[model samples]
Target: MPRPRRQTGFAQVTPNLGEHLDREDLLAALRAPDARVENTTLSGLELAEVSADGTGFSNVAFRGCTFEWVDLSGCTFSDVLFSGCRFVRCEMGRSWLNHVDFHSCSAPGLSFAKGRFTGVSFEDCQLSYVDLSEATVDRLAASETNLMEATLHQTRLRHVSLDRCDLTRATFFRTSLEGIDLSSCEIAGIRVSSDLRELRGAIIDEGQAAELIGLLGVRIKEDE
Candidate 1:
């Protein structure tokens, strides 16, 4: 049996200052070494194969942007807002995100392995087939989102709230789902390679547990 995780919460998470500038200068900054962009608002930008690894961005707002095959691995973001952004097959492994909010985004095939997210909220987003292996998330809120077939191997969830999310066929192997309450989310076809101990300390409603009877190999005999 796994030890019960302590109840944890994230408080006072806010974005810091950022540099307010145009789109061309932001592109130029990304090309420089140790680039750090802060307090900037860039919109309607289209980028492909952009490398944003290990860069620092603070209080940056991006809207109506599209990224294709872009690599954002190991990037650090603070108080950033992404609205109406479409990420197609982008790589975001080992990134650090704090106080970030994503709204109305379509992020399919977004690789986010080994990432750390705190005070992050996703609303009305489609995140199908996103890989989040070995990630740690705290104070994360997801609402009206679609996460079908998303991978969550060895991920840790703390103080997370999910509402109206569809998690059909989502993979969860060796995931530490401590302090995560899934009372209002739709969880169907969730594949778990490990035993039920991996779901210890998780809060689920009765209907959700009944949906997981097949995973538990339980045979509920009914009277004829």
Candidate 2:
């Protein structure tokens, strides 16, 4: 099989949305088993503790919506756009996302473990403490996002870009960073394996190199 195409730039998502749906209609659609909500737009809705597992959303746009403690595990999202949305403690494990774009969203403590992502991009999002463990990610781009203290253990990433993102104290156990660039991102206090093998073949600036060196109990002194 041919290799997957690399995603070099930001995600270009053009949702083919149709009629606007109110909160009641949206909730009703989500209640159905293996639901597939298509071509709809829902905005400015505040939902809490919603259980909508195994649902699929296609060509949907959610603007300024707030989701708290929502369970959306095993869900599928394709060609979906989330703008200015807030997801607090949302459970999205084992979900599959394709061609999804999250713009200016705040998703602190959002759990996406064991998920599969393709052609996804997050721009100007606050994703602190997000969980992405054991996830398979391809063609993903994250720009100006705050991923501080996020979990990425055992995650498989291909053609992923993290531009100007804050990865402070993020854990990456058993995850490889080969061919990934962290020059513009803040990677202070990132956690990895003791052998430091995860950082092999990864691109970083001089300052980042110094920080990694410090992890190996080595200090660099400037020339007199």
Model 1: pairs clashing at backbone N, Cα or C within 3 Å: 18-38, 18-39, 19-38, 19-39
Best by TM-score: 2
Q: Count of backbone clashes for each model?
A: 4, 0
- Measure candidate 2: CA RMSD: 4.8
lDDT of 2 by residue, 36-82 (tens): 88777787889998899489888788889999988999999988888
In order, candidate lDDTs are 0.79, 0.88
Off by over 4 Å in 2: 1-18
